[model samples]
Target chain A: MTATATNKQVILKDYVSGFPKESDFDFTTTTVELKVPEGSNSVLVKNLYLSCDPYMRTRMGKPKPSTALAQAYALGQPIYGYGVSRVIESGHPDYKKGDLLWGIVGWEEYSVITPTPDVHFKIQHTHVPLSYYTGLLGMPGMTAYAGFYEICSPKEGETVYVSAASGAVGQLVGQFAKMMGCYVVGSAGSKEKVDLLKTKFGFDDAFNYKEEPDLSAALKRCFPKGVDIYFENVGGKMLDAVLLNMNVHGRIAVCGMISQYNLENQEGVHNLSNIIYKRIRIQGFAVFDFYDKYSKFLEFVLPQIKEGKIKYVEDVADGLEKGPEALVGLFHGKNVGKQVVVIARE
Target chain B: MTATATNKQVILKDYVSGFPKESDFDFTTTTVELKVPEGSNSVLVKNLYLSCDPYMRTRMGKPKPSTALAQAYALGQPIYGYGVSRVIESGHPDYKKGDLLWGIVGWEEYSVITPTPDVHFKIQHTHVPLSYYTGLLGMPGMTAYAGFYEICSPKEGETVYVSAASGAVGQLVGQFAKMMGCYVVGSAGSKEKVDLLKTKFGFDDAFNYKEEPDLSAALKRCFPKGVDIYFENVGGKMLDAVLLNMNVHGRIAVCGMISQYNLENQEGVHNLSNIIYKRIRIQGFAVFDFYDKYSKFLEFVLPQIKEGKIKYVEDVADGLEKGPEALVGLFHGKNVGKQVVVIARE
Candidate 1:
């Protein structure tokens, strides 16, 4: 093994009780050997882009019951999420010192990962911004693809409504629905995000839910025909309102419930009775279930990104020291788009 | 036209707002000429057994936006529901005088009807009790079969949890799950209903939800392995607890939400976040959607009924005057089994 190098990490101070604060994570430093362990097929990686996702809020909570949604971030341990990393040393034949990959890695400057096919996908066609791997091409991309097509079972010309429209998964869902000849409407928290949804993401209509007193009335105004598919990102009140406006035989793809996460008490959904009256199908899914379709997702989305047919926006925070703020900002809806912490521009 | 007969009818007094009282309906007399009009395909029938169901509550409310669910029962009109009748006159070739049919009928002693294939099922196998058509071997039977097999997608040895497990659809769902070799557990309002779920319906275990202080704890005690499929009958808090107890990728077939139907304020479901974490699928379905499978269903269930593999109990009210009490009894859990109002025996 070569000489050890200094590694900086963002550590979870403890399990969060309510809305997460930046103080919940502390900056720390450790030393790591540059070389892969002897007789092990692990790859030593230098982290480039670390994703700050709404799902991480769930991990911040005390580990109560283990769920497929996410594993709890251990107290006093480095928080982990999807990231773009360059291999610095390789013990596996398929990976080398220069190969780029996107997968689960530590929220730190360096990580040694067991490069299993399931967790990691090789970064092919890196001509597009490498940071795209953190949002558009990584977990969020598969989430948008699988949640919309497989779970929602989208039909052409169907009306789609997306909540948290400016976030990582929501933006892509609107674009995909629009591309498939759907009339898409989206809801976000800010005027700027709402504008971006309509202009950049090409949503047929967009509204700032925070500005609207009655979400059901807002939905009624935007979608006179009623929502056929709802790509749910923020749950609670948004879900309840969407339920009231859903068409018969509607589909709701529960991708994330950002609004409910980190709350001591989750907002109760009242309009669930509408599900029976409308024959609605509300399905909850994880992108992990569709990782097997990553190649197919890449095949479809890469060209769209290259041709400027698909667009992605990011809110980038510099250095591991700013990681806490970037992750915490998600709860406050501070970030305009996909939030990422840049460890280094490898 | 033959001599007119005085028909006793149950008419909706007005659109119900909250919980329906017996006064929501009025007993009245209407004269009916028991003859098929010239060149009309409508059948004139003597209504026998009238089904008192939870879904009728939806119809009792004033019409809102149209849904594929039950149509609203108009004010001052005779309320209609599923019933068994003997055809007194028929203009359609498919039916003739003396033929027994079961389907949608007015809550009256006699009704003249246009009977389409979708609205009527001719009784082919009457070796069993004729009143079974008002409960099992009718809409509730098809509901249980389709909701369990098609929606829940049961596999042998899977843990099944059903609410309202001694009611019409719940009883059959538990029994069907048991027949499929599942570990079935059910919840009902009273000790009698709970006991019926275990000893009579063959559910592996049962609990009286009213007796349990904490339903989630009861479910945990009953299903330490967690629920694989939840047949949701009475929704609200029961659904909230079930969400917490659901296994990964569990399915919840939303059959009815009797608890929420009549309240001026519907109960908000709190634990829906578990859906995303568990990758659960909650689907609302109507028995009308699976009517085409009626033939196939009868073929599967008829032998079970004859050989006593399946058992159904009915709480029968003797007259049309008692229809309001029989139907209203469902909400208070007064009926031990399927509640039916017998307008006439033959």
Candidate 2:
């Protein structure tokens, strides 16, 4: 074991409301061991590529009575998120030095993970770009796969609608549905994303939801027959409008509700009555619940990636210092595809 | 063949806004045929017990662009709901004179149904009271059975919670959970209903939601370890509170949101974030979607009913004149149990 040393970390300054600022996280140096401690069941990881997910925005807020997924980030503590990392040292038997893994790691590069590791997986298939593990082959990829297949239960020739069409999960979901022989439509905030969804991701149709004044009418125009399945990534108004245009027995897979994450006051869904009237099924699911199927997902997705049957697009920020901006960009729809921050290439 | 004659019917006077009034419906003497006309594949039936469900309140309003299940009732036309009826005559090959069926029927003494006769099912189980067709062995029964068994996926020794506990669906859900060896808890509006849940329906615990100042605390008291399955019949504050007390991987079957039905603005759910952290699955479902399982449900529930392993309660309001009030009573938690209006006994 190497000698213990101090490390620098980025700690959450305070809980945020609405949109978060860079000042919300403070970069500070603190003493820490570079090596794993003796007899400890922990690993020392150096985060390479940190994922900027929209859901992390909710974690920046104060601990509420019912924040979904996990507890709020503690004040003055290192804020953590999904990151692809190299294990510098390991005291646990399952992992060894130089082994690669992707899991929850602190924002600042180094982390000491103890007792409960959040959805950690060993990187077995290294043929793809390592950064691909940050988005396409990691949490976001699993989210799109499980949420669409397991939750939405898409059928061939069905009309599928996806919100946040160019985001990590949304883009993949639309593509997967299209591959399943479904008529897929996607909604984005900008014309750029709309084009990417239609041309790049191969969505049957794509629209800029921000440009449309009447979302329900826009949906009706896109899906004259009504949407058979909706991949709900952005909640609030989009959800309300989608409820109106959902066909009888439509299925909605609630992956994440980006629109409501940073709001001081969450938007109310007005057309919930459609859930009963149309006999629609709206289900909220987390990727972790489908971890048992991860091996199977990898078996399926990896071949597609290798064969060029599946294409992934990423908006990679250069450094860890720009991580907050990359993350906040998700809310404003600035990131065109999967928002990721590459702290280091090697 | 019997001569065709117009029959008297009950019509919605106008669209209702908040709590419905007695004047919302008018029983007008209109003539209807006792027999189906030639060249039309339709059925003419004499309505027996008309079900006064809380969902009917939504139909009293003007046709919104997105009402899910049943279409909005046309102004000056008779309101319709689930009912048990005797097929007096039929032009459809599937039905003939004197066939007993239960399905969508006018809130009057008779109705003419056409085009789709698949929604209607012949009454195979007749040992129980025919009024059971209005609830158990009908839509509400299938709702309780499917919503609990199919959606919630209860396991033995799991903690289950049912809102609107003494109502048509909730009562049966609680008893079904108990039969499955689950620790069932229920919430109702009044002490009588609460007592009925515990003493009559075999719920492990029951509370009057109206009396509880803190719904979350009440849930904590009932489920010290947290609820594993929640049958959500009443939405709004109850849903918000239940979110806080849900165990990891908990399942919530959204059967109905009766609490938010009449409100001009739907209540915002403040605790939805719990859904992500606890890995909870909140799914909205309708009984109609589970129609394929109707026979299976009857096979399961009928024997339980015969053995007195399951008990059902009904609040029967006599005459079509009291129907509007009885239907509206559901929203305010005024009805003691399953609110039903007996149009005729024989």
Q: What is candidate 2's lDDT per residue for B223-341, written digit by digit as tens?
A: 99999999988888888889889988899888888887777777777666565667677777777778899888888888888998888999998877777778877778888877888
Candidate 1: lDDT of B34?
79
B299-324, model 1: which lDDT tens digit per residue?
A: 99998988999988888899888889
Among residues 3 or more apart in sequence or in different chains, the pairs in candidate 1 whose N, CA or C atoms overlap within 3 Å are: none
Interface CA RMSD of each prediction in angstroms: 1.8, 2.5
| TM-score of chain A, every prediction, order shown | 0.98, 0.97
Query: In model 1, what lDDT does residue A101 have?
Result: 96
Worst 10 residues of 2 chain A by lDDT: A1-10
Best model number under DockQ: 1
| Error at A189, model 2, angstroms | 3.0
Off by over 4 Å in 1: A66-68, B66-68
TM-score of chain B of each: 0.98, 0.96
